[model samples]
Target chain A: MVDVVGSASSLHYAITGRPNCSLSAAGTCCVFLSIATITLIVAFGFFLAGAWVVLPFAGAELGALFWSLRYVCLHAGDYERLTIDHDKVLVEHHTTKQDVRFELNGYWARVILDCQPNGYCRRLALRSHGKEIEFGRFLSSEERLNVGRLLKSRLGGYLS
Target chain B: MATTIPIQDVHNEHHADNHPDHHPTGWMRWVMSTNHKDIGTLYLWFSFGMFLFAGALAMLIRAELFQPGLQFFQPNVFNQLTTMHGLIMIFGAIMPAFVGFANWQIPLMIGAPDMAFPRLNNWSFWLLPMAGLLLIGAFFVPGGAMAGGWTMYPPLFIQGGPSYDMTIFAIHIMGISSIMGSINIITTILNMRAPGMTLMKMPMFVWTWLITAFLLISAMPVLASAVTMLLMDRHFGTSFFNAAGGGDPVMYQHIFWFFGHPEVYIMILPAFGILSTIIPTFSRKPLFGYRSMVYATVVLASLAFIVWAHHMFTVGMPIASQLFFMYATMLIAVPTGVKVFNWTATMWKGSISFETPMLFAIAVVCLFTIGGFSGLVLAIVPVDIQLQDTYYVVAHFHYVLFSGAAMSIMGGIYYWLPKWTGHMYDERLGKIHFWLTAIAFNVTFFPMHFLGLAGMPRRIPDYALQFANFNMIVSLGAFVLGASQLLFLYTVIKCIRSGAVAGNRPWEGAETLEWTLPSPPPYHSFETAPVIK
Candidate 1:
């Protein structure tokens, strides 16, 4: 789910992370459209047959499928971007409705990899000047750890 | 206890295969494991166990039917045997077996670490054995299992003993389990694909399972509602089905068949997915008409809802309604025919090989079409009126379900057992088992068509002198068919316990993501998602 464009040898490391989805936005819409159409026709047909109980379950199921698909499509545009150079670090996060950016001195930045008991990195963040900003929210645990390692290699441990 | 895996022990994909010993140990490993492979194994084992149990029930039913008059239990017990046989085989055996395939292959095929919700997957699988046990446990209850037919039609259902309530409760549990399982599969398929593994590019098995999950989500709730109403009619004083309370008994049939019809598709669609997967691998060609196959599956699943009334042509329907359902039922053949044609075209003039899986897939395609044709015969209003409760109906479903779904599961097991166990199965033994199963299956269920046409009804313990000969043939075939499954069990066990090393990609034609890894894949796989073009 994460796309790391630069490695330890690159002067500037650029990492991009995006949510997982089986289809593009248009594709998701097409899936939902077909499902919704069939669902309504089936539910309505049963309702006509006096089995009105079927409609609620069908509607609820339709809502669940749509909600899952919509969630995927909504986050489809969201991404996390990080740029690290010799002196400075840049973190940019974008959601469907918001974009946030931050810059910090690479000398003072430190990487935090909080691995859970199962050894997956549950969170990755950068800290400088007594403040911390997290990115890689959309990345898998391994990707998050890899990103953390790349950042740490650029910036040594920060002062406590 | 599971090994305490630390960050330092983890590796990139390059080293993952080097240290492939993260497998847990002890009893709790099975009880608390969240591994997708482990859970898939559990589901398969439970399904096979249920298959044997239900097949034993059929053996007893056949034993009693082997001779003419009252050779075994009385009619009430015979009723229990027939009802429990149908119910257990359908829910406990076939459905769970397909779910087992979905769990094992979906993540591996799609290049994901595991299911989207691993804990939820565990709950879904564990719930099945509980529900199966609850249903089977009813046999030990004072009045025996529910005997109002698996359909549980009203007035007969109205007078059943405590076992009826137990059946109702067990059905509820299974329904919940099925719904949860379907949701997990849907989410996993929709959101867990590799970066470039587009929907159009997914394996046919994935597509079929996805469609089947949707059917489950749509159908199982209706079943829950029907059974809940049945429970209410029995104890809670609601007349949802009670005729004495001004409810129409036929209304229960309407509701039950509505769920029942889709339930049949639920059992078969995954088999179609399996056939699509296996035929192409053995043919050494890309699937012919992949898009059409996907469309056919969708069309078939969509048509399942509108055709429920076809089962009720004998229940005094309006002539117009009868005509509509009959036509709608027949319309299903178009898509089903598309599937059959696609399988055949895929095999046409190709370098085809008959691995055990391929054999089962081929047999499923041919025999299931026969089952479908029989269904068409039954779909005719007048024909079904005579054949309503006859052995022909029983034969039709066994062809569809046993040859179509159950055999595909057997085939699917043979196809994947090598990959799963890291060792090649006994091929000669596998082929022998497949032949025995394929031949005996026909011997058992095929003759019921003639018996049914002769007007010998189903679910009866005794029959007239005229019906005796065919029943005996059916009983003999049934016994052979029942015994052949033992060979299948041994083949699987031997493969798992020890065999020649099956290196990764045991079948050179296999192009899926799973085959790219070790024969038995690492516990954690696709550490960095392999982008599929």
Candidate 2:
């Protein structure tokens, strides 16, 4: 599905694939915090019962859980946007940490679908004049194919 | 998910469509991969390596007992071998092997894109090798590995040297790895199922894994707590198990078996799932009692928690408590019996094929039942009082673990190897391996029952002259069993290298979602969610 963000003079397609998190951010935090707190209480109980060595192991386990949850959530914000008109296509890619933009001549743009021998979609990239930007990393293979096809058809007439 | 091969012309349309996977090559591909398939491969291979290592330790234990007297190793060294053997086989071999299966099959079966948290999946697996190294590293320490058996009971456990600390630390690491793995699996199974694939409709392997994951989450923490206390008593002067320090030694047994009993169920529950999957497939029938099988699984897991005291029957408890644990432990046999009966009913008079996997499945039913009966024998307090810590207990668990968990794992491997490698192993050789394994396995552990009945105690490096004959037979069978495993290693490697090509559904009656995908599957399986009908 395409989410249009610009006027007719300059059309834009922004395809964002967030982590499939069913819970809201706050709900996610609450769930994890509950787990951590319960684990801590159990460990603390053991400590009070004279098994204090369990505390560090519990901390490490909670720490791993916290870090992994954070990593998944952070990557949920990743996005890829393609802004194009009659002249050029500008591609902006947003990872969890940084945003990168690649500018290419719209007339020279080509959409490449790296597919498997069995026709499974692998990767989708936009290439032009030795400059390329690959996106759809978080998309399903079918979604990637649709995105590839959309770009190909929209830019077919302008191919240099 | 609909399977469609991309048009070759479409591929030719672009210049940069050169490789299917953009991940790194060589060693870094394994270490850096967040892909489920890659991580699964790493886990399987690592577990196989540990299996051989642990199996070697078993061979040594047998070699020492070949003629009743310690021929090669000292008592302490022998104790270390037994201790490490149990720890490695349970933690390093069976558990990780099943987790590998979960990693490889769960996402494919559920039609999710991948595990819920792929990076954490990677982290969970890598921790295993480190934990294994620590356990192994204890051998090189100044005092050698801890000789206090894998159970790590206090007093004796607390008296060990520096290596005991290493062992305890290793247990903590492995426990954390298990807990993390269970969390990842639990989240993935709960939230990542395809649109139409409800829980009941999931494959038996997935169902069993879901239950087993919960068991892990519930059980491993107690083990972690127990070991943590062991560590504290050893170093921190805290006597949680020390009576002199106002702690009770038997309390450690209570805590350890609280985890240990469920731990046994944890190992076998997935095997139950594997057997359920295999039996129906070979019988050319839908599972006869699918819902009952799931119900039996849940009942069995719940029952596991209450039966912990059964193992301590001989430890001097009140008659009421003994009676309670005895009856509770014996009651486990009922649900387990339901499972066995269900498998038998599933295969009763159907158009059955005796393929290698089915052979292992059938053997597991017969042999594991024998193990179950022995467990029932041990469950009776009067009998257990006579048989505790005897060769009888050894025979009982080996039957359950070797013939149950280990055999089912081998069956699963055979059933899935074609799919995993995109090639069929040599059928003739496969059957040969199964026969050798089945025969040799029984010959190895079955005699221990008689030995136990005749009053042979377990975990000792030497035996009296009266028990010499059975030990000799068991040791000989152990040698044969150890050698037969090499045949399995050879079969797997040969299949991977140059076996015949396998189609998407290698087995004729297989009808799981995994069978709908191509053999060897793509690196990114289920890129789109598959709709289950």
Candidate 3:
């Protein structure tokens, strides 16, 4: 009974995995766009209230600069994930049991992202305990080679 | 899933083997206790004893003023009663009660097993009783007890008899106690919260205490310096507040009010926190705008330091300075207003019930607002010139202190009595005590405002016949109010000894990790830390 229920959930995960990347990206973009739009509206409202065209224009320009500065400071990370489970595409950042769980599916896939040199990384990259994997290696050219070599050695047998 | 870490569980197992047997019982346990809770109980009982003693002195003052002809005590004795009453109540009674509350509650609230420095807590509490003994003992000295009032404003204080010396000594001891107590409180609160209980997450009672302790550490030394100068002038022939020595009496007033103004808030802000806690519990609501309430307390504490000179406006400070102080004093109302609004908003649209604790909490809200409004009127430069040193000032502070701090202390006692005693108090006796005291308090103080507006100066043994009838009524009400406290004393004791057994969570509307433990909690509560979700 437990095996049947587990396999059914795994099937559901495999079907929903790959498309989640676009959903997350769209959500982030919407939030950023809304905040930027609000800043523009408030700046214009202030200008109209003051009834000084030049003064309000200068103020709005300053406001826009501040808005962009904060936006970059908050969310400079630019990486995306492509996950698979149950010998099929699973929910991105999601997984199921018994499908070579630690196997990295995406490779040399222009994973643009920010990386803090001294930042903490998660232990056991996907819980197979083969070795510690540096997950954000896609952020740099040299890191891509190091990560790809490690992944090939660990997951080559599991891949199709 | 929310993780449950029973930190107390670990502590109990670790400390169980180390627990002492053959622990000493009886009076020696009290005298030699290094435990925070035991010392806290000592401080509380000592404060209550002083409260009754000072209340007696107040009755004497009222009795002498009853018929306006120096009927009961002589003029000198009347002055002595007035002076000692204020001194005893401010330093001996109210301040000690607050320190007692801090000692008892702060450790339990913060989930610390005990005060950071238990020995220092014991020493500080012990000094209080010693100081009280010396001060009270001064009545039997070569001359009567000091008659220079609590401020002990120089010239008069220096000229008084040997009791003056005794009073100064007692003040020094009390100052040491307060400074030590404040330091201990500050250290404990800063150093001892459970993990995940960040500064913002701390209860308001703890926050107000943090500010009050800071006020004490900063201003208390200045007060000690001022009193030292007074002591020198009295004994060493140095003139700090003497005109002959080229020192000004007004300088004494400046130093006194610098300590006195924040001292008033120190007495009352804890009451504000207590009311904040009790009102929301009874109303069945999360305290509205918790962050704003925190900010408002900080603002009020910062403003308290700057507005000291408002107390000395009539002492002929520069007109500009007077105006500055006046406006600054009035600005206090803004932060104070935010607190009141937050409390009222917390109770809005909630399932409100009037328990004994709630009744006192509500009375505190209404009566303290009246006091705050009168304080606003007194803050006006022109009006203060008229009202300063009058019975109006007297009426103003009684509302603030008695109905404000004292009411909340009673409420806190009732609110936590079940947890402390493992039994519930008789509700009927508590309600009767509340109503009688509230009505009698207003009756005693309200007429003083009219008397002051009619130009009656305070601290006088005699008054004109025109103010006679109201004075008589106020005096009668004073006796009744004094008598009403017996009900509270009786109810507290009866509950402590034998009342209905209470469960772990006595109040259905209560929230707080403290409620998640057994009643009268074990000798050690929460041996293991409880995880905050």
Candidate 4:
């Protein structure tokens, strides 16, 4: 998804992308815990009915669920942000670990959409001077194409 | 646990995926692969292998019953055949086959790179063969396989020797595999969907699997618990089911069916999901009521938990409790009926086609409803008491599992094989396979209904001479049904080896994300997720 700051003609755009997570990190934890809670309650219900053997197995299963979902929640905020301004193009890739940065001279920067033979975009990038930086790594192929077209028309770049 | 890798950079490993040399060659590619498609292929082939083995066991059982006297193995061996056939088909064939479909199609349909936990997916597939070995190995143990039926009821279950422990250990292994697979499915569906692919927007197949995973997570452990108690009774001297030692065997029944009946849905709900997928595609109509289908599936799964005691009706609970279970079991028919109605209505005034997949889909709706009605008939306490261990009970489940779950899996294969293999299966042979299966299946199992009503108990090698005629007819049908599946195998091989090319979208009506990519999609084709409208 792309965001615009300041006036539309100011030529400053923020094209941002993140993992598609409808449930927030907390909500994900809540969902996992909720399922774990219900499963334990049911397992204990059976245990009290003299099926005590169910408790350990249920605990083991929930342990897996809890571990996996916690892993997912920890990375739910992983995101990417690229802003094009008058002089510089700044790309910030933020995961749980680090905020990596990439910069390009805006005047010489060129947007590229590397497409497969079937017209599916394989990668989207911006190249300037002699270096290149790939963006929209998290977006879908079709989404990259849309963002490519948007950036090309505004930046006055030609398709390769 | 966090899914963070370097961005704004090229990892040599990511780029190496394109180099042929970088990919593992030969058996290593399959045995230790993290690829979802490879794992799905392994699961499918493994299940089919198990299917044929179990099917051969069924043939032996039917052959022994062809006449009315002991012809082949002894009565004990006949019991072994029946018990192993039930256990293997349910565990090794039907359940895993659906999981195979889930492994392959779920990621494709949801537009994810792969399962959330790729290595775990590989582990899930590998564990099946080990479990299968123990199962088949049980037959070679000192006293032969457990003959106490697949339910493994105590007292009779306790009488068995070393083979019994092998079977229990096999089940424990399978439970672990199922739980791991379910966790991957649940996490992937809930977290890894492409942007715009919301929960409600997911395909019915995905929705069904999501619900089915929950059922597995909740019920499979209960099964592990029940079997663990049985193990304790055998070696640990805990009388959980030992009536001779201050315990009730009926309690085992209560606990087993608590896991077992949802197991019935665990096997079929995904098939219902398959029907929802195939019918609308063949009918050229949007599903008649998508939201209700989802709600009805949840309702059906919820009902499965309460209605398990219906299986134990003859074991004697209170009259009120019996009535409650009876009504609860019967209540399942309502959501089941809704699913059938929606499938029918989806075809109403639409461009319906009778492709092989469609043929199987239509047959499943009609035949599974027949099975559901039989279940309703048995839901009454009086009728259940009459039909409890009879061939009628056998007839009912075969109708659902064989015709319903098994057939849906076959249809789904036909529906998706073109996409998987990049070639259309021989339409001629596929149709023949379907007709032979549908016709011969009825010929084999239909008469069992009559044999059952006339009081021929199941799991017996011989019956009274009065039931001889129907037994002969049933045997003939089982043989023909068994033979037809070989044609199915040939058709698949022939399609994969040499058939007309199928471009990306083989079926014009297919609108899922998988179809949008190339047929036989690339190894990393889904690295960029597809957005739903």
Instruction: After superposing candidate 4 on the true structure, give the runs of residues whose Cα lies further than 4 Å from its correct spot.
Output: A1-16, A26-30, A81-93, A97-136, A141-160, B1-25
Q: What is the lDDT of residue B365 in candidate 2?
A: 94
Spell out the clash pairs found in candidate 2.
A119-B6, B1-B530
Sorted on TM-score, best first, the list reads 4, 1, 2, 3
Q: Compute the DockQ of candidate 3.
A: 0.01
Question: What lDDT does the true structure give each of the candidates?
Answer: 0.84, 0.82, 0.71, 0.87
Runs in model 3 lying further than 4 Å from the true structure: A1-160, B1-17, B20-24
Cα lDDT of model 3 by residue, B1-533, tens digit: 22222212212112213322223469988888877767777887898889999999999898888886868877788888988988898889888888877877777777655665677788888888888998899888876888877788878887889888778788878987887787577656655565566778778888888778766655565566567778778888877678898877887787677678889988988888888889888999988888998888878877876798888787788888998999999999998899899999999998999989999999999999999999999999999999989999999999999999988888988988888789999999999999998899999999999999998999899999999999999999999999988888999999999999989888888886667767886555543344456
Q: Model 1 chain B, TM?
A: 0.96
TM-score of each predicted structure versus truth: 0.87, 0.86, 0.75, 0.91
Residues B275-314, candidate 4, lDDT per residue (tens digit)? 9999998898999899999999999989988998999888
Chain B alone, TM-score, model 4:
0.97
Per-residue error (Å), model 4, residue A145: 7.4
* Candidate number of the best TM-score: 4
DockQ each candidate and list the results. 0.18, 0.17, 0.01, 0.33
Q: Which residue segments of model 2 deviate by more than 4 Å? A: A1-160, B1-19
DockQ, 0 to 1 scale, candidate 4: 0.33
- Cα lDDT, model 1, residue B373: 99
Q: Which run of 10 residues does model 3 chain A get worst, by summed lDDT?
A: A14-23
> Which lDDT tens digits does candidate 1 get at residues B175-207?
877877887787788778988888899999999
Report fnat in order of the candidates. 0.19, 0.13, 0.00, 0.43
